[model samples]
Target: MTEATHDDRHPMTGNRTDAGVDTGIERHEYDVVVIGAGGAGLRAAIAAHDAGARVAIVCKSLLGKAHTVMAEGGIAAAMGNLYADDNWRVHFRDTMRGGKMLNNWRMAQLHAQEAPERVLELEEWGALFDRTADGLISQRDFGGHRYARLAHVGDRTGLEMIRTLQQRAVDLDIDVFMEFTVTELFRDPSTGSGGTGGRISGAFGYWRETGRFVVFESPTVVLATGGIGKSYQVTSNSWEYTGDGHALAMRAGASLINMEFVQFHPTGMVWPPSVKGLLVTESVRGDGGVLKNAEGERFMFDYIPEFFKKETADTIEEAEGWYTDKKNHRRPPELLPRDEVARAINSEIKAGRGSPHGGVYLDIASRRSPDFIRRRLPSMYHQFKELADVDITQEPMEVGPTCHYVMGGVEVDADTEQSIVEGLYAAGEVAGGMHGSNRLGGNSLSDLLVFGRRAGHNAAYHSMRTKQRPTVSAEQVKAASAAALHPFEVEGGENPYTIQTDLQDVMQRLVGIIRTEAELRDSLAEIERLKERAKRLSVEGHRQYNPGWHLALDLANMLVVSECIAKAALERQESRGGHTRDDYPTPDDGWGALNLVLTLPSDSDSVDLKHQPLPVMPDDLKTLFEES
Candidate 1:
């Protein structure tokens, strides 16, 4: 993967160095470059290929190992296999409500309408979902949905979905470059006839295996690099979720919306210290697990938010009865949206009602039979047993909130998945405005499929229709390569790992699930201090498979994204959904009227915040809520 430093006659490594004299960098061309290998990236590449375009997938890890593989809950789709009355409208209503009415109406509508089709397509691609007695794909209950909408393969739904998509992509012969970290997006700089300011031209990155530079030149680029969970100390997200796409898009002049909202899932393993932030699948609660305090009381009923009072049961009897007779009784308080449940767990711990490990008890052992538990949630059983040395079938597990998902990201066109940058697009969690303030338990999966396909199709069409070919100057490539190698050149400086860990501590302690103006301001100040440290960060050893260098590059992205989150959180004083401000503890309709948008100017390191009015839902879609 080493780039050729000299022009012409440079030894051929069987890779092109982008159309001309090579600076020794490996270069390739494609109609579309999808910068991720997860579900969304794979689906986007597949769609682009089917739409008559050459596509390549660049990922930070080996195929099939993306964070999407760690998703335990099922894909939310209104398949109605378990409940005949369930449909897309109900799913849409639930999603909008779950997001606290902050979701893009069009995106929510399109996701609900298209998710079932995408799920069925995955089945056709050989995904074997758990089936009902009638041989239809089985659907299960999850938080925020009105019915059994999540089509799952037990609790390993993401693995099955990714495996199926991966196989399909491999079968289609989509070009894949694994272990590559894209550091910079190349856009046209000329403001003349055809300037790069509006469109993306290519991407510059390094192969992780060899630590050499690689360039991907494409007419269109799709960013599907997932979330920013790694910015926090405790998170269910993997190492790859380091705000790559978010920061990359921001650098390329894209705006991020609703950056204040970050979802802390209610059921992460909170014991043994080693696996403190490991995700305990929501399927555990969906399958009748109840949240109890140290006092052995079902404490969720005591913490139900006013917004969900009408939908959630007030008593254990009604809550328990609803599982069997949903038509007559409201859902259990434990089955409330992740934000509400996470806040409740936070409150309990603050009030001295938490378990010995600083979390609340999530018990399914006393409710569901052992056989049923093993059959339904094999992964949870094994995860608890192997990771925490606790058998979930025999005992209640200590669980608490862990940073799970970011509801804000690169703002994009809801229908096409294209960002404000003409040739740049985003999908899955990287794209914003789809989930709004807080995402439902299972909608993340469906959001990927629905928007991934749209982004791919539109990107391909744009690529084919464009008359001009965007250029990536030799100077731009050299600059990218130089920036990547700077950490190695420094003789003495702060360790990248120390800076990252310090940044994480700042985020976890000050800008976490519950925040205050003072703490957020402190976090911003800490981020500024860390930014200086990051500039002086250094790493030992060569680039080849160097984890330190990798973290160094990731640190830059995380710093920018952390600033965006803290800044937005500070501006939005009122508490709503995932962004709970201890200082301002209630939702404010006036604040809801506008989304806080973060943008980075080309000339400045500072992030500018602006208020973008929330799009009014059309009367037709608003009618659905009226009916509810």
Candidate 2:
């Protein structure tokens, strides 16, 4: 993408517009405004409307285009379709263990207990999930689950999820503002209604299509924006995942927990450069695929962690038996949680056992019939054929780690999904403490449905019962507008794209999967430098369909988030779940009990990190883990 010329344009001015694009500031009001259009946002909006509130859904992309569609495995829920022994208690135990027990116990409990209902609700709302012999929704296997517990629509489960949620939203008549990017979340003036000094007032953003500013005056705001993967170069996240919600919450005085826990999925494509980091879903392994290195040997058995050794197979024959008879044989090491698999892949590649493309091989062709592969993993077949000209039905695919999701985000009340800031709520991937450290493949969809509904229900209730609604202050809007136009105001400044590239380089090289003190510290120092460089950024073109200008706006958010990750990574010395430290190399008991939470005080230039204790699981819940 080439930069546009200045060509006699005035700074901080966007009066002109191309055909079919609007100009000037626009305003609207709603009882609740959700600042994303993913599974979480759509579910939240529907809940708000059900509660008799006028809701609005604002998004950076068109409806049904949120990164939720990128999910391939399925929506996880212990629906007991295949295994009558499967239940919420077992699901809860699997979730907690997969996260290395760092998950908020209550949140995990709620997610496990409510996931089945949520999936069934989706089916009722017209999600076309694959069915079993008895016509029940099919459940598939995924890493870390005790039973086959993913409700899926073959490999296009995420697509069907977003489609169903979007249609449900459309049928409810909820308002939507597509292609609007929210840059700043606003709050009431100190002297405000209901005497609540820091209640949510509204949100501010510009239209990507029209380059015009729009404001929504609302009493409550739900931040359902997804992960922070785009901050890294190699990622499964779409272009939209720039840590927007995480940064927005921190900027608005909310705290983020476990900021260092970044999940790198094990099976991203690693070929042809262009689609190198694209996701190759966990379903490949869930069905029967094995990981092999250059020696054509299954390498996962050599890297199984002690934590999962009890349930994982040590022999190839036992592991193979699991595909056909799960009750008698142990699961394969290939079915270990994502962190272990990704790290094993990294180890193999580092030891010169990598594929020609610098990754390992995921071989499903040798295990399953061609028809079974196509019927189950159709998306994987098509993605491979079109992108790399390698047919998955005939050969193994080159795969490696890619920054996929962040377990860290806005810390919220486990039950209500409300942040410390009144009227500001978060859910789905944007909320912290759900998947403590490493997330299992299918649980993300379940998390979206459960907590998204909680956030929406609470936000709507809060908006309706509050005696008076706070008004957005003019001063706040002016400050936000100035910050938004910073890149344009500076003359002869550095290019925003250059800053983005540099930021990605630093993150991928230093703060990525395997981190160290020196690397994280160096990352922080570079982040500080990048922040300074970002302030002087310049974009030559108007915002209307300007990818360069839009990215310029997303730069500040990325910088703040990268700093949070680096600082948190530096603070936690021991390895656990997603945040692995090369120096420390193992989990520390004291560190495991504690969490690193970061917050950005409005008056401060730097974020403050503090040690907080993880919530203790209740006695009744602890028994679930104790049972063999």
Candidate 3:
């Protein structure tokens, strides 16, 4: 799979370096270029091909190995397998409420309506989901859902989903360029691919292995490059999530919305420093796990959901002494209630009642039988035993907050998924307005499929309808190539890894789950200072397979995105959904109606923040909220 396009018309090598790209650089042409081959990118490519477009998928990692594989929860869709009364309307209502009503109603509506079809489509493409006694695809309940709506393959649903999508892609012969890092997106290229006067032109990147440049000229581009979690010090995301898509969209002149809304999962592994921040899936709590602080007290009774507090509040007094009883841990059991659990752990840690590793204790050992633990959670059992030397059936696991996903990203048209830049599109975690302020546990997979299909089909149609071809700017390509190589040219300078670590620390501490204006302002100052120092980062080795050079390139993206998060968090002045502002402390009605958008102007290096009115939900849709 070395720099080659797979198709009937192309050679086995498949690579078309002959596109006359500035000698030595490989170049090719396609109708649509889909970057980031995660679930969304793969789905988008499949959709583009079905819409009669020659599609190419460019990914930072090998195909089927995108961060989507790390997803532990099942895909959310109202299939009605387990719950006969479940339907799209109910799912839509749950999604809107879960996102605290900041979600674009149109996107949420479409996602809810189309998710079931997408799940079935995956099945048709050879995905094998766990089935019920009736032999229909099994659905499980997740946080914020009223019924069993998630169709899963145990907890490894994401891995299976990717495998199915990847195999489907193989059967379709969609050209996949694996291990390619796209550093720059070229808009309106002038001297297009290889002097081929009327050639496809848009993207410029490089192979991670050889370090040689590669360009793809396409009329339509879909950015499914995932989230900005890697910018934080503690995260469950992989190394590739350095906000490449977010930064590329900004550079391509697209705006980002809700940049401050980053989701921090409640329980990431906190022991054995080497495996810290690894996600201890919510399933542990779902299948009976208890949260305790250093004082050996089971503390969930203190943090039940506000809605259920009245009924459960009185029981708290009765349940207080029951902490001595092992079987009583699951008594109040409103389910771990993700938001409340995270808040409770943070509170304990802040009060210095945390575990030795600075996290609350999630004990499943005394509550569940060893056999039940192994049967229900094979992954969790091994994840703890192998990674941290902690046996879930024997001991409590240290858990804390770790950045998981971002609800903020490139704002796009609800239906078409196109960005401010006409042909540029985004989906999955890279596209916002769908998840709005906060995302539900299983909604991420559904969002990827629903918007991925829309983005691909629409981008392909946009390509088909265009009368004049857009060329990639040669100057932009040359400049991008130069920037990729500059670190090797520097003599004495800062180390990219050091700068990246510092940036992550700044983001994790200041612009994290809890925020304040002064901390955000200080983060901004530190980011600006890092931005200046990053200009002088030097590489110890040549570009070929050089990790240092990669970080140097990624540093710019992390810096810019960190700036966006910090600036947006600073401006919002209110706590809502995933953006928790310590200073403001509560959601403001005015802020609820307005979305914060950050756009990078070509003339300036800094991003400019502005407020945009959220699209009004139609009367018919608004009535759903008013209804029971």
Candidate 4:
């Protein structure tokens, strides 16, 4: 199929100039521009720079403190002999099982194969992962890993990983633009045809430090802007994960796939309203923590499905048996995959055995010594002590499901990160079909490493091969600049914070872990109202270092992402991994075989939703599956 081109109404075509005009704004040009500075963005910039391309890494936050710092758990890999016979094949099968078979075969294959090297690469770059006596990187069990495959640095794995990448990027002399937000893409002006004109030219954004608009004209733009978990109030993700990449890509005419499949992490802190939804790392359970009810009963064995029944233990005795003989039995009941644990918790809550916080309790007090708990789960101790005044080593932690990751994102070919939009590419959480309906715990970090480098390499290679410098029209920069600055123009009516809060509340209440058509429709209408209110919302201060103004701008992107999610949820007729529809309580085979693709409509208020066929696996896929 041919690519879609920019319409006459597209902002890029309004101005034509062979030599790119700066519009007197802060003009930065590069061979490649990366929109996020997290793990993927840093890695992409490093790769692009190493490939002899001049690159820039732009982020909305301080250097080294991107959303990646908040990632807990660990990076997934398939290093053999962590358990006997454990390899990429087992990791692949486990991931496919966890995702309910909706994963892109090629992406999954690549991830399982390449993740080990990526993790080791981090080690080579000065990441200090906890190691075993044999001198290999120590591995831990996370939900959905058939073996102990997650390589971690205690519980601050993301911090360790991101710091390594950030330091590496700095070491490589990659241009870093901190506190800059890319609001829109610049398209090539020469191609007027629908499919051809959509080539990406550059990007326009605002610099928080200067309080001025900035534009970059680049031959290639890689969007690694991460996931949209902040769309809901109860999320384990950071404030920076506002789905900027997804929204920006959709607006640029790329199709977003599986948007309805948002993964609600099974264990988030459920107390102290301020930090109520912060993530309690899966590493807690991985280190032998147990989930309990108000009556102190272990309950996951009762909820085990037939698929996992053979591998999983049943009673407390059986679970205890595995700790002694790891090879003879599966890990304890608490270490079941996230979806199973979440459903078990939901069932317990419904059965009136929940904790005081309306969730269940996760306790490790009886399982391990205080020193071991303190050393392995330091963040859990610090988080509870600072946020809830509870010592995890001495007390049971209150936990429940909270929106964490989006399994759905821009649909792309597995090997190539190219989206439906020819010039547009996405990787990491911004690109989808790798995790299917639900992602396993540690897979995300590994995914970033594998795909981020691939995207950077491919984008750089493509730009070099084409030798076409796509120009950002002067008019496109001006329009994007005006739109970005419009948030500060509103001086009265609703506050952006209030509108954003309402948007979160609506999404969490109606379109959350479970959904129905009526609830989804209500969410849509409420979102429209929220969007209207957002237009009238105002910021009280100047743009320089103003979080309020930044939020005001982010709200527009959040609203766009929320609308797409709700619309996609409403259209899908069956329950899938992360997207559970009450109206259609079971998964339909027809729906299971396809992915939902959402694109931004010409009228920005509505979304254009479509379905695309999933890849038909060839003989190689069968071999990979069998070996896995």
User: What local lDDT score does residue 145 receive in model 3, on the 0 to 100 scale?
Assistant: 71
TM-score of each: 0.96, 0.94, 0.92, 0.92
**Residue by residue across 1-628, what tens digits does model 2's lDDT show?**
2323332221124333231222235667899999999999999999999998999998888898999999989999999999999999999999999998999999999999999999999999999999999999999889989888999999999999999999999999888888889998888756233212477889999878656667788989999999999899999999999999999888877889998999999999999799989999999998999999999988887886666555443434644534222245357678889999999999999999999999999999999999999999999999999999999999999999999999999999999999888889999999999998889989999999999999999999999987888888767777877787767667789898899999999999999889988888899999999998887888776656778779988987898999999999999989999999999999888998887899887777698999999999999999987776
Query: Candidate 3 on 143-258: residue-level lDDT in tens?
Result: 66767688888778889999999998999999888888898877663432311122234788887876778778888899999999889888989989999999998987788998
User: Cα lDDT of model 3 overall?
Assistant: 0.83
Q: Higher TM-score: candidate 2 or 3?
A: 2
Residue pairs clashing, model 1: 3-24, 3-25, 4-23, 4-24, 5-24, 188-196
Ranking by TM-score: 1, 2, 4, 3
The list of candidate 3 runs beyond 4 A from truth reads: 1-16, 19-21, 189-201, 305-337
Q: Worst lDDT window (10 residues) for model 3?
A: 321-330
User: Model 2, residue 261: what's the lDDT?
Assistant: 96
Model 1 misplaced regions, further than 4 Å: 1-20, 191-196, 312-330
